[model samples]
Target: MKWLWRSIASLALGLGALGVVLPGLPTTPFLLLAAWAGARGWPQMEQRLLRHPKYGPVIIDWRERRAVPRKAKWMASALMLSSLVSIWLLPAPMLLRWFLTLFLPCVALWLWSRPNS
Candidate 1:
């Protein structure tokens, strides 16, 4: 069980690291997941993540307030809007496109509704 938690933590941390350099790939959520899992099996890793200079504050803010920074909300919105436009332009099935079309706005709305950290 500890190993399983550690593995999840490692995987999520890797993805979160990748998200730092990859556009539209969110970093905070995966890091949050990593920290959560780490707390169960790897306290050291969790501490390291929490102490990280760049991401630590945001993670702490989220844990304490369930807040989302206003800048992140805008960036997420812009990315989702671009993705929606790209989906519409793609030669894909209407159903999938429609699903994303409906989904992205709901995500944006939910993101926007969060308190700014």
Candidate 2:
């Protein structure tokens, strides 16, 4: 069980790191997941993540307040909109496109509803 949690932590952390450099790949959610998993299996890793210079504050803000930075909210919304446009332009099926059309707005609404950090 510990190993499984550790594996999830490692994988999520890797993806979160990649998200830092990859446009439209969200960094905060994966980092949050990584921290959650690390807490279960690896206290040291969790501490390290919480102490990170760049991401630590964001994580702490979320854990303490369920807060999302306003800038992050806007950026995420923009990315989602761009993705929806790209999907619409592709030869994707109408059902999938429609699903995203409905889902993305709901997600954006929820994100916007969160308290700003």
What do the candidate models score in CA lDDT, each in turn? 0.93, 0.95
lDDT of 1 by residue, 16-84 (tens): 999989998988889999999999999999999999998888889989998988888888899999999
Colliding residue pairs in candidate 1: none
Those runs of model 1 whose alpha carbons end farther than 4 Å from true positions after fitting are none
Worst 10 residues of 2 by lDDT: 52-61
Each candidate structure's TM-score, on Cα atoms with residue i matched to residue i, is 0.94, 0.97
* Index of the highest-lDDT prediction: 2
Model 2 per-residue lDDT tens digits across residues 9-49? 99999999999899889999999999999999998999999
User: Model 2: how far is 15 from its true place, Å?
Assistant: 0.3
Cα error, candidate 1, residue 75 (Å): 1.4
lDDT of 1 at 68: 84
Tell me the spans in candidate 2 whose CA falls farther than 4 Å from its real position: none
